[model samples]
Target chain A: MNFPSKLIEDAVNEISRLPGIGKKTALRLALHLLKQKESVSESLSQAILKMRTEVKYCAVCHNISDAEICGICASNKRDRSIICVVEEIPDVLAIENTAQYNGLYHVLGGVISPMHGVGPDELKIASLMKRIEEADAGVKEVILALPATMEGDTTSFYVTRLLSARGVKVSTIARGIPIGGELEYTDEVTLGRSILTRVNYSAE
Target chain B: MNFPSKLIEDAVNEISRLPGIGKKTALRLALHLLKQKESVSESLSQAILKMRTEVKYCAVCHNISDAEICGICASNKRDRSIICVVEEIPDVLAIENTAQYNGLYHVLGGVISPMHGVGPDELKIASLMKRIEEADAGVKEVILALPATMEGDTTSFYVTRLLSARGVKVSTIARGIPIGGELEYTDEVTLGRSILTRVNYSAE
Candidate 1:
């Protein structure tokens, strides 16, 4: 598209470089920002610059943090004996938002995917082992909270083998039909797995 | 959602302030930026700040520009006898992309919307009149390229009435079925107008 101004063109180009945003969307955003007060763009740019330049990663869990250790890893109230292993930082946020898990998180960065040239060595697998093996940390169980894809399963199995040999119980989150899912529309593999892992009737 | 870091939270909040972006999408964008090189974020922020702070508007048509007069208005190659009136800057860009018209453009900033407290005085209608009234510009025709909405029509009628009194011909873009649109699914009003204003067939 022919941009009226070089500044707008530059802004739109930079914005469209972001994942999921296209040139049209970037142009829309640039126009919206132009219509808003100068302070709005000022704050937005300042926030992004500050976040990118000053953002820290948790030394223990590799999660984005403001300090050397993340809040979850530093908190005494959380279940320190169990670590919920996730494939990325967003997954940690997703699980945290659920409010179902009280344990700390270990961000693996990514799962093993040979197609993508990503192996166990490319992820934070070594750091996870180091955390679990720490004498005073007392980590007992390692929960694999990766996706349901083959890469996720492979990473889960790989982590499980390593943790099992290190004398820690290894488990994965249950695979089942979603809460509001209908049996008729449920995919075959998920339905089959849910049936195979059916639990005894226990009123909670 | 619980953000892992305050920096991420602030960046997400600022980003979500943009039109059509939500909290989750903002988080996703922020995380994507975090994963990319720090220089990427730096360039993005720099571009946004530069665009917002240094952007200029055309003195003649009120379109976004780098100089006092926009490239379109400054170009002698463009047809000087006719001007296409549009609702916003993006409309000018859209028409330019079509490459169908060689006339100049006058962006009205927005249409007259009483509900939104917008009126003709809020638009660049006066400047448009002044441009036509100029002795040497020789502008003879004003094309209403506004949307088919009530506000757009109202603004069109108002502008046409003013330009008509000045002895300048006023016309509107044809209302018709879209080029790829099927007649079976065409809306009644557009179809009705398309049939009413049918043009004579030309072999070419």
Candidate 2:
């Protein structure tokens, strides 16, 4: 496919590598970027470069943050006694969008998947346990808001066992979500129900 | 909605400005960009920044080109006398993808749209007429592959009148495409038929 320029082609290739974007859509996106005002593209480039440079995981919650601790972790009004365990920073955002859960969050960064070679150690599980044990507020409940995937279940099981031995109440979201659909695609109502009807997990 | 970082927010906003993208999709795209290798993002950034510098409109054909003339206009073997006029560079790429049309092309840049305040002066109509009048190859047929929209029809009518006055045979693509549908989305077979069965428009 003879592109107008090598630069256009390179941008398209990079964009196509993204989730859900194809080559044609990537080309369209690249063209759209090119047609935009110089400042718009410049800001976008600068943003990506800056994100790569300055963004880091919160030492407390493991969520992407610009500071040592995320805004959620720093907030004194939030329920310090409760911690919501989620897969990624986006999941934390999803929960926060509801303005429903006032509890703090512990972003696992990823789920435990033997197939993908991601184990419990690969995630921020140890930090979560340490947060529960040594927490100044003495955490009472740990809510599992991970996706209802096989890997998600595995990670949840591992966390529940670790937390139960330490005598912390560990629970998971209800089975209201569809079997295979991702948590990101689920509507707020269903997600809210899944969170509201959460059940305790018996450590094995 | 309270993004973790200003940089991430900027990237999301920039991606959301594209044709069909929304805020949610933009965030996903931005996150995807963040996950990519540094070199990939750098290449994408440089490509976007270098668009105007690397690509220029062909001086003769108005098609996007790296050199003074596009590949079609520069090619010695192509039928220089038969100029197929289209609305944009994407149309040129669509036609070339078929490997059927061996004729040179003239890109109008856009069609006449009085509602949107676009007119002949805004398009490359004058240059097209100049190309025909300054015919080094003794040009014969001028194919109008402009869209089948109202504005496209008006542009085709305007071009046909100007060409017919100079004793040139002007033709338009057949009416198989649905109204308001773009030529870019049309199937190759349907587009090919439209090209093959083009009708002569003798200005009354």
TM-score of chain B of each: 0.97, 0.83
Q: What tens digits encode model 1's per-residue C-alpha lDDT throughout B1-204?
A: 888899999999999999999999999999899889999999999999999999999998899999999999899899989999999999999999999999999999999999999988999999999889983958878899999999999999999999989999999999999999999999999999999999989954
Highest-lDDT candidate: 1
- Per-residue error for B28 in candidate 1, Å, reads 0.8
Instruction: Quote the positional error of residue B13 for candidate 1 in Å.
Output: 0.3
Task: Give each model's clash number.
Answer: 0, 0
DockQ of each model vs. true complex: 0.92, 0.50
lDDT of 2 at B101: 85
Q: Where does the lowest 10-residue lDDT sum fall in candidate 1 chain B?
A: B133-142
Error of 1 at B22 (Å): 0.5
Interface RMSD computed for candidate 2 is what?
1.9
In model 2, how large is the Cα lDDT of residue B180?
A: 85
Model 2: how large is the Cα RMSD against the reference? Answer: 6.6
How does each model score on lDDT? 0.93, 0.82
